[model samples]
Target: MTNPFTRRPGGTPGAHLPLALCAAAMAVLALAAATGLAVDGRTVLGEPVWLKPFKFALSFALYAGTLSWMIGQARRWRRTLWWLGTVAAAGFVLPEISAITFQAGRGVRSHFNFETGLDSTVFAVMGGAAYLGWLMTFAMGVFLLSQKRTLERPMAWAVPLGIAVSLAGMSVGYLMTAPTPEQAQALDAGLKLATIGAHSVGAPDAGAGMPLTGWKTGAGDLRVGHFVGLHALQALPLVAVGLRLLARRVTVLRDLTVRTALVVVVAIGYGGLTWLLVWQAQRSQPLTSPDATTLTAAATLLGAVALAAAGVLLAASRRVPARTPVAATR
Candidate 1:
């Protein structure tokens, strides 16, 4: 079967440019990874530079790939693709643009000690990156829902509405805490210690002990947000499939009931997984602990169960009752 996203109109693919850019960006990322690994020592490489930029580049490439594939489908899909492209650009630009403000104060200072000012420039850049990331999800949700073949109005709104609520809640919390200089310093110390213990915080190390660097230094609740946020990729898509199944039977009470139950099960499973992540972060235990190990195993099991149940429900919904052929009245 033809890939739904990649179908295009005439000769010479419309996405050629974007696809080429994606390939180039991926190549750059590969080079950066090799270079990062090949260098012997920290100082010998001068500054560990290419990796961060490469991440941004790869993000663009992924977005571009999505756009290239989607834009050629139909007018509606094309519109959706345009929005997605805008979203992708914003995701890449926001952090870089925000970094300018951050860099102005520190002038390329990437180190963090307790003495480092509370307004660490990288925070601004990262915050921008994160906010943009969420917005990208919102746009994606809209596009997914806009699928004329299978889109329920309520489900379509969920992505944007959920994001708005999450961001609002987070913003309210930020406003509530106007940390003192001393408090900020303490927070910095805690973060630094966690980073030191973890050895590597970010910039994907396949061998790195910690799978999640986002929760390394954060409190439980904060860590939960980051962890769940990370898994949105899986949770959202599963939920979407479930919703599509659920919406089909909305008019029929019996089938609707099954769908509703399926949706609830899916939501609860995803929510539980999210909560566990937060709890783990709050606990701040190393990944090697028996308890942590058990919890991870349990979470994986739950995810598998949820996915399996969803698939079963979707299949069952598609099965219509056998129809007898009508007698020839003529």
Candidate 2:
């Protein structure tokens, strides 16, 4: 029996090395954060400029590490997948992180900055890299789905679900890039400014936030959904693993039907939450400030999810075989 985490002999090195290197970079950034290195400007959240690099470094580490683990499980197209994943990291992730870090070091905004030729170029490059990364993720999801039988049942389902949800979540950022009415008016008023691409809605990016996350407390922030959706890759698979362990302990619930139903339920719930966050952000409502509309929408989502879960469980129960009761020895 082989441990999934350990690299097999003669296996092609995938994103593991790049992920490790990124981890090292994250360590350096963490040190910088701790040392309070001289960062020229604060983020829109008024946090130390080092915070951006520190956060991105951690995110990249998780992204690379999770993908590397999944790629290692690939029984077919191992080398090709490795190459593709590496290209994604090198061509997309690395460039984006580097550009952000570079801008942070210079005490300037990396995103939505069309003020100068250089800033516009960097922003364009980052945007291109982001699109490429999303495409690569889509490809990875397709490959995982094609090889579903080779993976653990929970993981097999999780891979595609996670990627799909993450992409959906990421799409919300596009709305933020559109020029607000005020921004358009400003542009028409002889201002050289092109558009504001920041994440906050109905308010400026600079404001009171929730500690390190920097999510706006006063207004809607699309990054909440974006962050939650991106992490589904990790969160879903982890929940699947836990469910598998629980199934082992509970004999009556050991059927694959039950386990699969649980996974489906969790995925649906997770997706609903992602949508709720995005919807809330669009309405310019803070996470903490839920009004009547929010409550009604939330209730509807929960009711729908509950109905779906019941249907799945009932359908599964009918298909699954009844367990034989064992007679106790006298």
Best by lDDT: 2
- What is the C-alpha RMSD, rounded to one decimal, of candidate 2? 5.1
Which 10 successive residues of model 1 have the least lDDT summed?
194-203
* Residue range 1-330, candidate 1, lDDT tens digits: 332243345522255244445546555654664465356233211333333343444444444454443344233555455556555555644454345323332434222212344545454455566556556646654664455343333233333333333333233223212343444576677643211111112221223232223222222223334434444433443565565554444432134334434544555455555445444433544334326565776668697767866675676557633331221111
Error of 2 at 118 (Å): 2.2
Q: List the residue pairs that clash in candidate 2.
A: none
Residue 309's C-alpha lDDT in candidate 2? 71
**Against the correct fold, how does model 2 do in TM-score?**
0.86
lDDT of 2 by residue, 1-330 (tens): 432233557653334456556556666766675454454445534766777777777777777778877776777666556666777788877899889888877777777888788889888888889888888888887776776777667667877788788778767767777777788888779788834677788888876788777788888988889888888888888877887677555543456556666777788888989999989988888887888999998999899878887786677557655662221211
lDDT against true structure, model 2:
0.74
Residue pairs of candidate 1 with colliding backbone atoms: 224-278
RMSD of 1: 9.8
Give the Cα lDDT of each candidate.
0.42, 0.74
